[model samples]
Target: MRASLTPTDAPLRARLLALALAVAVLAAVAVVATVRAADRAAEKDRAQPGEPAAHAGEVTLRQPGRLLFRNLAWGPQRDRVSAVPLTATSGPRTSAPRDCLRFHAAAGTGVCLRATGGVVPGHEAVLLDARLRPVRAFPVPGTPTRARVSPSGRLVAWTVFVSGDSYAGGAFSTRTAVYDTRGGTLHSDLERFAVLKDGRRHRAADHNFWGVTFAADDSRFYATLATGGRTYLVAGDLASRTMRTLRENVECPSLSPDGTRVAFKKRVAGASADAPWRLHVLDLRTGRESALAERRSVDDQALWLDDRTLLYALPGDFGADLWSTPTAGGGAPRMAVRSAASPAVTG
Candidate 1:
């Protein structure tokens, strides 16, 4: 019952229908392409193993100094420092191992504690220049555990585990030492420093000092002093060669960037043997402590992300992953990076 169309009208209608279908096909392809691109981006965010996400272009240090830490995947005997660019979040660059067991860097200088294996079994500290080249090396004692350089890169410190001071089935005793890079001097052990507890000297041979964190002045420091089956946080004066206890149950203290607070690991009694420590922050001026949101046992010293955030390593099956939390406390912990340990960021 429809009227017949003219020949020209029929041909024009056919062409219009073809054009509409082509446009629909192109639209569908675009949608599919967008979805695939999003999938690739998500995958890149989670870097795999030693591979960091590829950068878009040349990466440079926007903050002038890069982060430096120990690469746990490098193995104990062959561990090296992982230099992470401040401007670039991914794709860290690796430097020579140089027999470093643990390392930390600040300012323009770096410090590496190397462990020697053989019949003697000793440890040593190696100093590095701004270019990460070894400038000087010296022998140290005990098993290497921690190393730190001052903010100015003029002072260095280390902690070593030695036997004969640990309780039965207890953690080994620690020996902490500091060196003056400019003066060519070394304070072999801090245990000899006068220990004052509650305004009185604590005379005990079991006294062990470890995990030394330096102040900006380089002449003042803080460390964990463990004695009499208890641990205390002690503020030390380098020139006076004395340590005064600040508080109890605090260990592995790391000062915040602004020097207002100290992020530390608190040993909690009655917790599981596997996870007995909790992360806490202490206000240096007020002596107030704020418990972080992280409740799991954190053993490593925390690295401050800024004046308000902290970075730490939580032990995992394949090394440890980097995590961050707010310095004010009561915020859920978030993963900042993966497969890293002993984090040190340059100022």
Candidate 2:
């Protein structure tokens, strides 16, 4: 049974009802505003007139002299894996039927790191076949930043920014995973790899690794290791589960096609905190390092257009653009592709 309101209480009951109605109305308005905001953002992502054209088409790893990249030229195909002739990178693009924030390919294999739009945002590493179809997907622990497929297509590596974002202040945590594509064997954390620093076995809880570049042998690799507020380039051996530190202040190492040199970003002295890295190359045989002519701080793991030139992405009007420079440290940076990023040279 419920008690009835008296004449004096009637006014109080009416006031409560009015309050509830007002609350409901406000909530409805808020919902509408949020939805409208989302719609506006989606519309903005669609390509406007004058944007370089892209069309839905097949993208494959088997196409030689083809350049693959994540298309940033807004439209129905924005963020799709796209391909153009390597010699004609500025030409119209053919978009694949998949999305990746960062992508790389080699030997008929691809690694696509993408966002999984769940109630709580998530991410995944989706492996791709020569046809760019999903072979398998693996859960990534955080925001994807770097990805690579081994020269032989038998190994894959990816890095995620696990915590924080300030690279120069040592406030970030990174997780790198290397996997064998043949049977889905994954080394989920390179931190577990035994560290041989200063020619001695070292241990520290602060260790973090990222930006793995594989050698042609697949078992051998290179990556950046961070500890003690500094980063070092480390040579890794999957067969032994160990990494030997080579040089300091080197990040995002990319091995050359001939396996004789490495291209990387170095945090040089007297650079701004926000943009502290410069493009550089190291001769593995002589231990000589030289800064490339690209004066702008390059932050991407470079892709080798050939043994002679390097490709990387920088901020551009359309999110990002690919640029190339001579690896021998003498040339101007040339724009290779507009509104594109994460380039993979397929052949």
TM-score of each: 0.77, 0.93
TM-score of 2: 0.93
Q: Cα RMSD to native, each candidate?
A: 19.2, 2.8
TM-score of 1: 0.77
Model 1 C-alpha lDDT per residue in residues 1-347, reported as the tens digit of each score: 99889989988999999999999999999999999998766654454555432222222112365665555443332245665675654565554434367777777677778876799877788888766678888787677777888878889998877764322225677778899988988898998889888999879978888888889998998888888777788999989999999999888899877777889998777887666788999998998999999988887778887888888888754477778899898779987655566767866
**Who wins the lDDT comparison?**
2
Clashing pairs in 1: none
Candidate 2, residue 18: the lDDT equals: 100
Candidate 1, residue 198: CA error in Å? 1.5
Residues 1-347 of candidate 2: C-alpha lDDT, one tens digit per residue: 99887898989989999999999999999999999999977975678777778999988999999999999997889999999997778889999989999999999999999999879989999999999999999999988899999999999999999997546667899999999988768999999889999889989999999889999988999999999988999999999999999999899999999999999999988999889999999999999999999999887899999989999999998799999999999979998999999999897
Clashing pairs in 2: none
**Model 2, 277: alpha-carbon shift in Å?**
0.8
